[model samples]
Target: MLKKLLFLFVLAVLCLTFIPQLTKPSSTLVTVFKLTENPAVIVKGAQGSALTVNISFGEKEVEELLGQLTKPYPLLFVDSDWASRFPHLAEEIKKRSVPVALLGVQGQSYETDLNLFAEQLSQFEKIFAARPLWFRTADEEFPSSLLQQLQKAEINALGSTVQWKEGKLPKASKGEIISVSYHSGGRPKISDVKRLMESRTYQSVEDLLFRPTVKTKKIPQ
Candidate 1:
């Protein structure tokens, strides 16, 4: 009897150490960075809710990725830059007029980190016009607002593998340069303009315009 009990305990410990989290996706929104052509992952949650993401984890290539998953979340988390980073994609979602909720993340030890996050979350509240739900630790999981702000304030993008390519540095431009789509791509002399687009300044008004510069060429008539 003693030997059998010890074997069962050992087997349970081994199973716990070796097994992976094979549970299917659940219903929840996630805050994350932008996506690239390489396949992004699905953290998985309930489908068809407002996905107020902080970034687009997988740019436009999410179709194949989403199709492969047993549960494909149709929602776009549009609370912050996650959705707006992809300008065209954001516009498409807006055209559909889908509703989204802004979610914020607080860090662990909110007591030590409350004041700092308060300042950052002030801007988020202005943007969302409501308080955001906070997650204590990235691993802590369950949601709360106090934790959300703390996380955002401390979540620095220092040593991530995601290599951000800054195209044009904003420089002197006419009529308050609206967006990169507002000007041209592949130009190196427009960093400030890039900042404007990145900061969601271009999205304030409805008439933000973009068109290819037309040059008239003289031809024999």
Candidate 2:
């Protein structure tokens, strides 16, 4: 019985030794760099790995800012009036082949707001030649009704920030939210960006965004 017990202990030790450690947290994190009111200054000065940039369409020199985009980074368009204000930016974005997401309703209560949201979506579809699958909002809390409407509109993802949690970099696709880890002030370092770019989780999310949606196979009767 003592020999059997010793053998079991040895086997358990071997198993523990072979098991891999959990290096990352349970959630995946993505990092987003929001362009301040002065995007040109930020873009020109900022240094980091590949990053998704957020731009408000109504900002001045929108074309100039876009023309400066030499590298292919994801772009997030904020404000509902972007299409109406800068109708040609979409064409430029298409030429650049950048991923795009639009700002969505944030806890809108009135029916008029909903109507406006629909109008904005229609405009976006017309401008981009495809519906945007991702959205972001300023509100920390959202209504279920608003969420249902977004889902019904076929939005596949939402974006949030983990900047509040200092020293913690987020992984990609945490539930329905694509959480981003970025510095609140100044630009992130290139080394840090490189790490994010190299992560398997980030690559997985990228592949998911670019992959074509699966269609049901038709069976002949």
Candidate 3:
């Protein structure tokens, strides 16, 4: 009798714990979508031209990802000094026809110093058998001086986040080469903008290449 009573008490405690979750207010149960301050963007100089995308993954995942895609996507790879650990990543990127860039070469002192951008590019070329045409970062914030330095390095195209101040574009290098911005979400979901994706299905790469800056609306936290 004591064992059965103890079992009943434990069952009641379990029910109390789970019942609250099941009986949550309907308002709290609604699906809410949060709009990020910075939306993903793609920059293509011309309508019919290729757009660039970025990935921060190792060789095996990159290879498997590329194998599954039927269409051509211009991938942007950022190589760092520590990339020596993944010696085969460069070759994997080259075979996939992705563009390579070097990170930690700009303002972020926590990473590499600004001086190593060119050096890393050179190192990447030797290692990957392809040259990177642009200099960029995961967080696309470049001071004016760094912009000039990158331009001087012959990195005509720049990949960065699309930022605006007080309804106006920031006074960065305006007439320079192509600048690209992508969804800040490390793992971007194409389904979030399914309607736009479907409308531009025929031009998937070109459509997806443009930045997905959306209007900011208040959403539940």
Candidate 4:
């Protein structure tokens, strides 16, 4: 009888220890930088009740857009190639104290040319006085080689869940990242953006990432 009681107790302890392990969900691998072709997948985080905005700065309209914005400025992904041609715009961005990311080379395959990539990176750093924390390709697709380079430089890849298309801004809900770009034929009207800002709270990329209330999820590579 004593032996049987001891055996049952041991069995109960083993079950208690191992049953949860068998039933619990597997831990997911969350990466700081998510590489995906799907934009929705990239912005999968608990965003509370605000929308995040990413503005691709390449044209004069961006300056007007900047003037219209108030507090909680959107992240401006400036085109390094364009900035090299228009230093005045870069200076304007610096003067405003707006947060910025690097919008990779435009109209050229800088990914394949290391020298060109290096030159652009150097030029951007010279103008901004700091390296960019985030980078996005013109088409939002990154080559593995270029991705590796960005990773080595500790730059995170940014993607948008919503985009302005066909001369209209897509209706986006809270917790979405909307990307507006002049190079992509989406010339955001200052009025339209201002209206959206009035309707909803907007957050920068840094705020979206580091917000204590927001919960981040693991996205598969």
Candidate 5:
């Protein structure tokens, strides 16, 4: 009986030491998607001439833009900096089922500013009930170290091919990503956005990136 009890205690100690390690998440580098002359990231199954729009601005501007857009809305990059200040916007985004990505606070040093980052992420998840899969910097520029950190966190980094300007609707190409910001000057006019929509179909960033492509079968020629 003494021998059996000692064996059981050893087994329990082994399980306690190894179980948490087995369950811990892996820290691997994830893919970073960005625009380049020779693009490193490609949308594998994209269809047609679809584009994605990412908007980073104030809550009022976002609300106004959301009201103006129809089906296939733009992806909003909510900054942790201002998310707490706009509870109504968060509720509205949740109510509307809008897609979102994390927009890092402008001029943030991710290495040293982790506390703010964590707080913002916590607040965002509290309101949205989930974590975002995508992330981008407010200035559209991401540091290499930050990219690695984001990858370890399992969040993909996204970059824009086109930066929409005030009073001008930049022509977007197929598979291109457009970023609209109030920080550039002011909120983009609804008319410009409408015109862009009329020009071509705009898809959510998630859809454009991950949606499976539908291939047409060629009838016997």
Candidate 6:
């Protein structure tokens, strides 16, 4: 009787455990997407052109949307993967011949966000080789130890992040040929901008040829 009771108890426990897993539905893990805000913009000069300087998703629309207008607007583009992903849109942009400039953004004291942005950027990243603008940390809120590890890993084994900022970024080194996206805004003084590109050790060939300012050939009207 004792043996039978023990076996029944064990079987009952096994069934209880197995039944919940088998019958209960799987739970979904919730994930939230954090969107990065591009720089706020202020445009001056030609009111004629529809194109505005920015790093963004909808650039090719310039032609079909308002290319009909007599004034053809062009964008001052930044060199990054975000620009590369849309070959079709880029093709449209090519037709328009929009001005493209590399606008780098480096973090000042916001170390945590900088590193977090880099790692997160790679997952579905659309631009540049690695995260641009190597700041001290990606996430300012993250604990310091983790940040140290990330810094050591990238500096030692992994490659360096982009080290340029379009405007003012503090406490981070700037590199030659800094790459940025359209959304990166607030152009630095011509002299300061020129200095960063010149100071960096090396430049990507494209950047070396055309640093600071690059004029796009006008589209045939």
Q: RMSD in angstroms, all models?
A: 19.1, 17.7, 21.7, 11.2, 10.4, 18.5
Candidate 6 at 91: error in angstroms?
1.8
lDDT of 3 by residue, 1-221 (tens): 99999999999999999999888866412321222223322233223333334454445544454454434444454545435656665566667665455543324532335565566667766776655544555455454445546555544334432322112223333221222323223333333222222322223332433443332211112
Per-residue C-alpha lDDT of model 4 across residues 191-221, encoded as one tens digit per residue: 7777666766676665555532222223323
Clashing pairs in 3: 40-182, 40-183, 40-212, 41-181, 41-211, 42-209, 42-210, 42-211
Instruction: Kindly list the per-residue Cα lDDT of model 5 for residues 147-197, writing each as its tens digit.
Output: 556555556666666666656566655556677665434776767767766
Which stretches of candidate 5 lie above 4 Å from their native place?
1-59, 111-116, 210-221
What C-alpha lDDT do the candidate models reach, one value each? Answer: 0.32, 0.45, 0.43, 0.62, 0.61, 0.34
C-alpha lDDT of residue 89 in model 6? 55
Tens-digit lDDT string for candidate 1 (1-221)? 99999999999998887664445332232343222122221221121111111232445343332232221222223324444455555555445443333322323434455564455456545554544332112222222334233344332111111112345433423222111111112321234323433432222111111221211111112
TM-score, prediction 1? 0.27
Off by over 4 Å in 4: 1-41, 48-59, 106-111, 166-169, 184-186, 211-221
Per-candidate TM-scores read: 0.27, 0.47, 0.47, 0.66, 0.66, 0.24
Error of 1 at 74 (Å): 4.5
Q: How does candidate 3 fare on TM-score?
A: 0.47
Q: Return the lDDT, model 1, position 121.
A: 52
**lDDT leaderboard ranking:** 4, 5, 2, 3, 6, 1
RMSD (CA, angstroms), candidate 6: 18.5
lDDT at 172 for candidate 3?
32
List candidate 2 segments past 4 Å from native: 1-50, 57-72, 78-80, 109-112, 163-221
